[model samples]
Target: MTRLLVVDDSALMRRLLGELFTHAGGFEIAFARDGLDALRQLHEFQPDVVTLDVHMPKLDGLRCLDRIMVERPCPVVMVSAMTAEGAEATLEALSLGAVDFIAKPGGAISLKMDLFGPTLVEKVQAAARARLPKARRLAERLRLHRAEPRPRLRPPPMRPAPAAPVGLPDLPPLPALPGEIEGAVVVGCSTGGPPALDALLAPLPADFPWPILVAQHMPASFTGPLARRLDKLCALTVREVTHPVPLAPGHVYIARGEADLIVGRRPAGLMALPAPAQAEHRWHPSTDRLVTSAMEPVGARRLVGILMTGMGNDGAAAMTVLRQAGGRTIAEAEETAVVWGMPGELVRNGGAEFVVPLDGIAACLLDLVPAR
Candidate 1:
């Protein structure tokens, strides 16, 4: 049986989560009221997975997470509130070592329970089985039981490549005005996108002309924090787009899971459309949906499609359609991607016009957008 520890200060939350996992079967459950209690239980129960809450008293979730990675290094899923602050903290936990997370429903218990409870149980099971990497193991060992101080981690060496081909048969010719698109900028990324996007967005100047719509493959609860983290790192305003908001230039809108981030061009303007129904593709906030919607609004001239690091061909098919519609397309090159699945597929299928490394992506985008 999979062993799980549920760490939360709220009794109701603990009970609900514990019961849900119990009902799911194949799980041995334990409970902790806070990070301190969690540590105590960690020694005693030796759980395979931990569901951690970020806002606990005495020791916050991140502190406990550091301790866990250092001492035992089990898979952890952070439980966070739905607010922006909660999201920011949860992303920090992910960087520290937590595998994934779930958001606690807002005020509506029934609605929240219905949406989150079963998903939480499912993620717990997945986490229990996930393999911890060697890098993480080394980091844990250094943090937990240090005989000597560990050396600072050096950034990985950069690998350079020849300039990517500009014009290909299946792709449209490079636009004369590379950076001058009129409508929203739609991006689809997964797997290695977190760091890749950091590089791609870092060099963008403030006062960019269009809003960015991103469909990143991630768990439902993770988007809030991921957006906040990106907001701090990027020049433009970044936030998780809730329902009914129109897409506007100058903002970066990220899509949450359990839905597809669709774009609609109303008479008034472009809007961020969310559908909470079951994911039509294997990935949520699907690249296909995002690209299709962007095509509807901007047609060829205004749409920009970027496929970054990820597994599988989720974006390939949609990119073909986007190209056909005269939208500009770019893919992350293999040399810089953690996994080249999505970007590689786009290149193989003739869906991408330009393939650039992570560092070069921002410059390419700036070149593509028109000067204001």
Candidate 2:
């Protein structure tokens, strides 16, 4: 059985989570009433995964998560409230190595929490399978998080079109395309996406002249908080895009986790057209639809489409579309991706022009955009 430790301060929430996962079967559940209790349980139970609540008496989720990463190093999923503070804590937890998040409505635990049983189960299972960071890599990533203003650049490259890492597949060589590099950038990612987003986004400078749009698989409650978190770290401005706001250069617009962020031109300027979620998309805030929508709206100008770490081929085909339209394309290299599905499929299907490591993607992106 996959051993799981569900940690929250509320007894009712603990019971609700326990009942749901127990009924869901497949899991051997253990519970903790608060952060201090959760740490004790972590040592005794040594669960394969942990579902952590953001706030708690005595220890709190952030401190507990830090210790777990240092001592045990298992996948931890954060259970957070939909409010801004909860969102901020959740983002911090992800940076600290938590695999994913579950956003609950804030204020007292209620029966309403049970509605997320299926999602909770699904995420926990994913967490169990996710790769945990080693002590050294974890240190390195955190060091970068605290690094100087200049974005970290990848070490010098040997093979321009490099050989794949030992265990990963040998990708086909991409044929070179047009040399001119003036255009917007669109990114689509999911699954083990947050850390990868940080790897790529945090390094770019504030005056990164082109407009960028990202459609990350997330919920309505989480996107704004994520944008706020990233904006604080990134040199470039980040905003949680809502409604028909006009798009501008040098800023980033993160699509609502639940709504698709579409792009088009208006008499005034380029604009964001976030539409209602469509049932057919499977993943809310579909990256494919967003890219396809932009093809018409952005006109003849070329664009850069990036397919990062994710579970499915959500952005693969659309990335191909962007590449065909005189745009450049990149995928997170197999070695660095937590789940290689999206970027892997993109490379196999010949959609990616560059397959760079996670830390290297920011450099590649800046390379594609010339100073205005």
Candidate 3:
């Protein structure tokens, strides 16, 4: 049985979580009413995984999580609200080494159980199997995050590509034609995506000459804050694609949460547009969809696919296609990924041209895509 420690201040929530896990089976569970109690339980139970609530009495989630990472260094999943504040707090928790997170169901909690229970059970199971990231690499990433910005060259002018043809919709189900783009980068990540994204994008200079399109699995509320946070830290301009915006050098387009972001030719230039998530795709802002769509507008030769730190094989198949079609692909090394499912699949399928660690991914990208 997998040992699980459920930490929440609410008696009702604790009970509900207990019942949910009990029904799911395969778990030897223990409950803690607050962060202080959780700390005690952590020592006593020595659980394989912990589901920690962000808001708790005696000690808040962030502080308690900080201590837990230092002392025990086990996999911890954050249970957070789906509000703006909750999103920010949850992102912070992820940076502090939480493996993954699930949004707390609010309003008519009992009614939401059917939708919540399975996801909770799934995350806990994943957490139980997750590997603790190496502290040295994590420290290096944090150090880079706090490092001063590097000097940037002025970005050269982008040559104009003919706009999308008339009678075509702005957002198409599929990319119209193979664009003649100079070069572009498509990134896919989940699980420990945010912090990994930080380490990847922070090291690039402001004038790095490839447009980066990212498909990160997250809720609607979280992606916006994530973009804002990344924009603040990264030298590159990072924005969530809510509308049809032309892709340009030194810019990073974050796919809107719950929507798949695809690149399509428009009257202006190559634009990043959010399309409705395809049912065939299992994860939201599907990486496979994003990669395939980009492969259409931006051919395999001019494109680079990166798979990093996510659970499941979301980008493996598409990236394999990209590599076989003569595109470059990078997969994060298993030693660095919290859940190696995504990138590991790429390697297993013989897709990745480069298998690098989280600390070295930015350097790899820089080496692959030269500055203008």
Candidate 4:
């Protein structure tokens, strides 16, 4: 049976969570009033998973998380309020070593209780079953102690070679078609995509002409936070998209967990499409489904496909179909990618016509989009 430890300062929250987990069964449950109490319980209960609250009395969640990582090392799911400060703290907790987090519902004790009751149980169950790798655990521990200071080292001296301006082979310019390209921009990314995405979207002018659809492999709970975080950093509007919303240009849509993002045409206009049933893919927000379904309404002429860094060839097959349909394709160059697997496959298989580093992707995209 799974063993769980629920830690929170609020007595009501503890009671509600305890009741929820108890009803969900197949496990043992322990309750702690605060982070310190939780740490005390850890010594006795040795829980399989821990549900931690960020703003607890005595010891804060991040400190508790540090102790747990160094001492017992159980999977921890942070419970945080939905406020911006709470979100920031929760992310810090994740960076500190917590596996994941669930935002507490509005301020009401009862509503919050009802909201988190089910999700809390589910996260605990999932956490209990997860087997963290030793290397990952060690890395997390090191990350906690290390101050992420910027590198100060200068580049090594190099022999002077060329005197002339360096000129790379220019990629074939995008064609000027008879009609306007009329559909969404679908992007598939994983692994090293976070920083890459920021770099790519930062340079996009405010009036970018198409709705951007993205399938980024991430946990469900992290998607919303990730979207919000990206929204702050990006020039375009970014949000976690739901099913049945129409596609609109100048906005960016990020696929939510377990949701397949598609594009469809309705009587009114073009809109975002979501599949009702869950599909099989190694990653949630599967790039294969996103890229393939995006081709439906947009067809070849209206699509722009980009495959970014990832471990598998999920988007390669879909990119081929898009390529055959005359959709534009861009793949990240191997040198700039964190894991070259996904984009590498596209390059090797002749799916991508253009290959560029992460830094230049935004400029390349701007060049592709026709002037409005």
Candidate 5:
């Protein structure tokens, strides 16, 4: 049985989550009232997974998570509200090392449990199986556990990439304006996507030759904050695709949450547009639809399909088609993935041309796309 620790400030929430997971079966459930209580039980219960609330009286969720990651790194799935504050906190939690999160529904939570319960249980189960990496440096670990933490969810300042190692080629600086669109890179990720995106995009130069389009599974309130956070961290310009935007070589377009991002041809040039999620697509900002639409406008050879850490097989079929049609495809290797469901499926389907770890994806892209 999977061991689960449900941490919340409210007694009602604790009881509801306990009942919900209990009904889901195959779970040994435990509860904690606040962050302090959660930390104590962390040792006693030794849970395989933890469902953490964002707000608590004595110690908030973020601080508790910091300690958990440094002391005993277990898979943690945050229980967040749907508000903007909740979105910001949850994103920080993901960055700090929590595997995934679920939005906490307001109102009589029990009444909404029929709809919400299944998703919560699903995330917890997935978190239980997630891989936690032990490769963090001692200093970085100390920073996270430091007594005086930085302001909550503060975005990292933008910084340029370090000099390339000897014998390695450095990325060419951004070319002069009026550079025509050559091709586009379409990326898809879900679970564990935020930090993975940081690792993938942070290493690229501000003047990367091709535009990057990202479809990360998230809600309407969360995507905007996520885009802003990423923009602050990376040298590249990143923004949500709220309207039809002309594709630019150096910018990164993030698909609006709860909608599908598709590519089409306009009189001016290739455009990334937001549209309602089609009934056929199982997930919003569907990666399959994104890749297929790009193929029509840009042609497969000009396109690159990058499938990263996520759950289920959302992009596997379309990326397979992309590879067969001469498009380059990259899958995040199983060794570094939190849950190898999405990228692993692509590999099994014979879609990916290169299987790389999380950190090497940027370099791999540089090698594939020419600066000239």
Candidate 6:
């Protein structure tokens, strides 16, 4: 059983979280009433995972997160309210080495908290698999951890698999541009996606010529901050999609968490965010819808599908469809993936034209479809 530490100032929250893990199965729960208590429990309980509340007495989540990452780096899942401040702190926590976060539903915590059970368990299990390295020096850890957590996601330096399985896409030679719009790349990722995206996208030059679309599993509050964070690190312009806007080359469109971000064929190609889906889709920013929607307007010949690390097979089949239609597609190799579920599924179904590690994904993308 995985040992878990539940830290929150509210006794009810503490008990509720404990029960959540209990119902999820395969976890040993330890409780901490506050951040100070959490620090004490850290040594005594030695949990494999932690679910820390953002607001706590004595030692708040931010300070405690800093200490935990610099002192003894481990996987942490922050539990926070679904508010602006909570979202900001949660994103900061992720940069500080917390593996993921959970948003509290509005109002009082009731049986609604139980609705979070499965997601909590999945994130905890993922964290256990992808523990951060012992951060080494405090200053070094802080500097590296904040700037780019994705590089840490890379396994200890090893020879990248020979370039055979990764190269120019197998599609037929392309025709001239349609005049109205240039080609585009649609990306799907979850779990440890932000860091992976950072690693994959930051290296591209500012003049990168293709429009990029990212459909990562996240909530409304989290996605905007993530885009802003990546924009600071990347040369390419990154913006969150709130209203429908035509995608421009050399820019990045991050899918809104509240809706399924899809491309539509207007007089010129365009971007549209429909109503948020409550059923028929497991994730809010559904990659399945994104890829399928691009088939006609974007065309398989001019599109690139990239399925990265995530829990489910959300984009696998649609990625295969792109391949069948003569478009290029790639998956993050298992060795570099945090969970390998999405990418693994893509490889299993033979959906990917290339299976590249985290470090090589950008190169592979460049090779598959040269920038316009």
Q: Give the TM-score comparing model 2 with the true structure, all chains together.
A: 0.85
State the C-alpha lDDT per candidate: 0.73, 0.77, 0.84, 0.70, 0.84, 0.77
* Total residue pair clashes for candidate 4: 4
- How would you encode candidate 1's per-residue C-alpha lDDT over 1-372 as one tens digit per residue? 988898999898888877788778998999999999999999999998889999999999989998998888888888888777886776667656676667777896545776777777766765665544222456544442332222222233322223323453344334334344466677888655565565566567667777788888876767776786777766677788777786655678889865778888777767888877454688887888788767866775577788887767887888866766667678887776656778888888776767877667776676667656
Better of 2 and 5 by lDDT: 5
Better of 4 and 6 by TM-score: 6
Give the per-residue lDDT of model 2 (tens digit) for 35-76.
888888989999999999998989999899988998888988
Off by over 4 Å in 3: 136-181
Clashes of 3: 3
Model 3: worst 10 consecutive residues (lDDT sum):
156-165
Query: Which digits, one per residue and each the tens of the lDDT, describe model 6 over residues 71-149?
Result: 5566888998898889878877765667778888887776676577777888888888873523335663454456542
lDDT of 1: 0.73
Residue 303 of model 2, lDDT score: 73
lDDT of 4 at 194: 55
Q: Which parts of model 5 are misplaced by more than 4 Å?
A: 135-178
What's every prediction's RMSD, in angstroms? Answer: 7.5, 4.9, 8.1, 10.1, 6.9, 4.0
Clashing pairs in 4: 246-271, 246-272, 247-271, 247-272
TM-score of 4: 0.57
TM-score winner, 3 or 6:
3
- What is the clash count of model 5? 0
Using TM-score as the measure, name the better of candidate 1 and candidate 6.
Answer: 6
Best-to-worst TM-score order: 5, 3, 6, 2, 1, 4
Compose the digit string of candidate 5's lDDT tens values, residues 28-97: 9899999999999999999999999999989999999989988788999998998889998998898888
lDDT of 4 by residue, 1-372 (tens): 888888999888888777787788887888998878888899999998899999988899888887888778887888888766786677567555565567787767686666557766765665565433122356534533352221222222212112211232323434544444465577888654554565566567666777898887654566677677667655678888765776666688888755667777788767776664364666657777878777776676567778887667878888867776677778877766756778878777677757877666676676666756
Question: Could you give me the TM-score of model 3 versus the true structure?
Answer: 0.89
Error of 6 at 281 (Å): 1.8
